[model samples]
Target: MSKDPEDRLTVGEVSRRTGVAISALHYYESLGLIASERTTGNQRRYPRYMLRRISLILVAKRLGISLTEVQHVFDTLPLDKLPTAHDWRRLSRLWHTQLEAKKREIEQLERELMGCIGCGCLSMKSCRLLNVDDELAELGPGPRRLDAAQAA
Candidate 1:
């Protein structure tokens, strides 16, 4: 790691280096997704490696993680310590599990949609192909003429 005193970055420098907007950086800070220190002038300063942290925030946002969830993930890290490679690897393992679960959910929804389309069932209550519920009350009443017998 570079130990040059000049290597420490200001918030503007981090924003320039990461190509992330300064407002987004502030938003990340407000969400507790990232951290910074205030200089004597009350300006925010960040470590040079915060570029990586901001990048991780962007990636997590793209993955559909809520800001609160992102904060929870960051909360697990040491407040004063920059993340090490081992820390990143551990986080990535958890992220992989989350991504896998999301993928399975999408696949399940796709299957359900396909079944509904194939069965020509537009009403949730009567659609055996799409409705996973065992009782009619599972879906609030609207239209119920979607049974296979009705289709026939």
Candidate 2:
């Protein structure tokens, strides 16, 4: 919010402003999702712009996006300034397809979960009535029946 491009915030100030813990900020830095400069006294100081990145990370987290994915998208963003509305739009567009696929996967799993509730045994050998001598194994690992159902 400061007009000064040199405006910087201490870790505690950033934490208070963003409602993020200082440790989490450090973790984000460690993961390369965010960065900071060290003072001569060895304290971390973040540019005011990093608040936007942290906010974006929190939103992505709530949407079930991984930090790796966030970092991938963030690689395209400018680090010296707050991301514009257009930048945020682009980020959302990038994530839209991934989120949709994840939604469909969750829906399919929910449907299959109901079907499995009675048997509850997803074992290849024990679920002979459904798996029938592990024939599904030939297709590879995971819930082959569920995956097959989805394919259908």
- TM-scores for every candidate against the unseen true structure: 0.76, 0.74
RMSD of candidates 1 onward, in order: 6.1, 7.5
Across 83-120, the per-residue lDDT of candidate 1 in tens digits comes to 78887888778888888998998898787777677566
Off by over 4 Å in 2: 1-6, 119-136, 139-152
With a 3 Å backbone cut-off (N, CA, C), the pairs that clash in candidate 2 are none
Across residues 1-152, which tens digit of lDDT does each residue of candidate 2 receive? 34453688999999999999999999999988888877789988888889989999999999899999998988888666789999999999878989999999888767656667778776765554466557877898787777878999
What local lDDT score does residue 131 receive in model 2, on the 0 to 100 scale? 68
Q: Tell me the number of clashing residue pairs for each predicted model.
A: 0, 0
Give stretches of model 1 more than 4 Å off. 1-5, 118-120, 128-152
Q: How high a TM-score does candidate 1 get?
A: 0.76
